[model samples]
Target: MSLEAPVVRGVELADDRTPRPVTASETVYEGLIWDVRRDTVDLGSGTVRRDFVEHTGAVAIVAVRDTPGVEGASQVALIRQYRHPIGATEWEIPAGLLDKEGEPPLAAAQRELAEEVDLTARTWNVLADFHPSPGAMSEAIRVYLARDLAEVAEADRHTREAEEAEMTAAWVDLDEAFAAVLAGRIGNATAVIGILAARGAKEAGWVTLRDPDAPWPAHPAHR
Candidate 1:
């Protein structure tokens, strides 16, 4: 007996802001993290100018464990840190920018895990990839699933400074974290996506997990 391929209907997505002919472009400001650029784009309807932030992209780690290898709810590592831009302390997962030249997203996530939480993981999976704000900025963030964790020694751990210096961390159950995301208690975008994605992946027996160093086409750094 022969089986035919199932027909999958493609959704008709409309994107009015497709990349148009750039008549003019220039950098407006350069900051420690990102750069602001002004561009004149022709939308076919008319020409409009706007300023946007050009980012290098970043990564977030959902450090989780489930009795090492057993199948069950896992514990997630979370952090509370001061975000000066928002003027409020927020709960989030360990994350950092892909700042280093030629550094991969997974490497950045691993570095953030060690730097922020003084922890390392033996198993890593790609959880979710998203654009924090595509309309205003070119910032794409990839969140990873990290397991088989181990704490760094006091002597080998990085000396936290700046925003990380005041950060506090805790381990929360996966289901509870998901509840927090649903309750609007977790405001961080990466954290919220990571928690919900992790739950879904867990329910699917984690068979849909991608490689840790999976190719991220949306990440400008990769481009």
Candidate 2:
């Protein structure tokens, strides 16, 4: 393998220097999403090794809802839930990881929307697709913007995992979501990037980014 580092955003990294490689390692992690493999890389010189990182592909759905307000009919959606990693509950847009094999990104988004909120979208716009952390994980988060909204016929949602606990969905204001993003309340990367991009498209009055090979770049059907 080439000893080159992937350039992202602005930084260009140097190649790693590992003296010796290990011959064996073990699975060091088991999580709700991904399993971690601790590998022994042969470093060519002596006996020193670093753990190699791997991950299952993950997707983050950026769900937005349409609201009819006097101030230009801005669209937004509710986002919250306990993130065990961060340990504090924050209100934002609905999003989750499709941390399973053979799962489609759009399908995961649709499911997450139905479960988190009781709504569905007739139109969908692909906002962005990128890795949240590329250094150690290979998660490609595909973010989409749902539009031309309609509610699902039967809202299948749950507050309890197996009916042991009660949970609820909260209403998220569109303006507030945007403002929260600006104020740094909305820390979810997909939500922030997708909403800001959508807003930028509206302000620019044109398509800012789209599928390069798509015939109808601005059309939602291209998503």
Candidate 3:
């Protein structure tokens, strides 16, 4: 017996923003960066109560530069920062929360790149966007592919504090970073997603990327 591929049907491969009715909602706990919210949602079949993190969304950067003397290869900046929740220092790309009021995603990404890594990029493109954990959090993240890099001037650099004060940075080959993700050496969700997506975009001749200012309708804050 032989089986054929299943018939494909859809307008396009994209996620829809369908919000369920919330009968009741309240903040269960408010933290520094996010809050836990409990809501009674009408699921059509039945109503269910659930608690999830109310995030402000964030942005990440895959700052890449051509490897000197290497053909068709690049190096991406990675930072090591201690995460209290995980109790471990993980390798991550420069990223930050969108806590500032009325900040665009691209602007946030640029700010994070400079603050976290002391670098700037002349070219930027949207590599990918995703919800880190849609089931338990409303944290939407947009990762950008940043190239044509340069260091931020000393006088203009922002002062670091807390975990960022002790953070360390390294420039690694893009392929090596992707391998680290596959090998589980790198566990930061945003880092893993950004590296893999950057590699995929590069493989596709960077045509798969969107403009840096592309509309992001899936972000909770944006919606």
Q: lDDT winner among the candidates?
A: 3
Q: Which residue pairs clash within candidate 3?
A: none
lDDT for each candidate structure: 0.88, 0.59, 0.92
Per-residue error at 58 for model 1, in Å? Answer: 0.6
CA error at residue 88 for candidate 2, angstroms: 0.5
lDDT of 2 by residue, 1-223 (tens): 4669754676664433323445877878876757677666665554544443455444444455545555654667655566668886655465666654555566767776776666677766666666667556545566666766666666354444632133355555556667778999778777787667667655665365453232322222222
lDDT of 1 by residue, 33-78 (tens): 7899999998899999999999888899999976446466588999
How far residue 209's Cα lies from its native spot in candidate 2, in Å, is 5.3
**Residue 180 in model 1: lDDT:** 94
TM-score of each: 0.87, 0.66, 0.94
**For model 1, which pairs clash?**
none
lDDT of 3: 0.92
Error of 1 at 182 (Å): 0.6
Please write out the lDDT profile of model 3 over residues 99-173, one tens digit for every residue.
899998899999999999999999999998899999999889999999999999999998999878999999999
Q: Worst lDDT window (10 residues) for model 2?
A: 212-221
Q: Which stretches of candidate 3 lie above 4 Å from their native place? A: 1-11
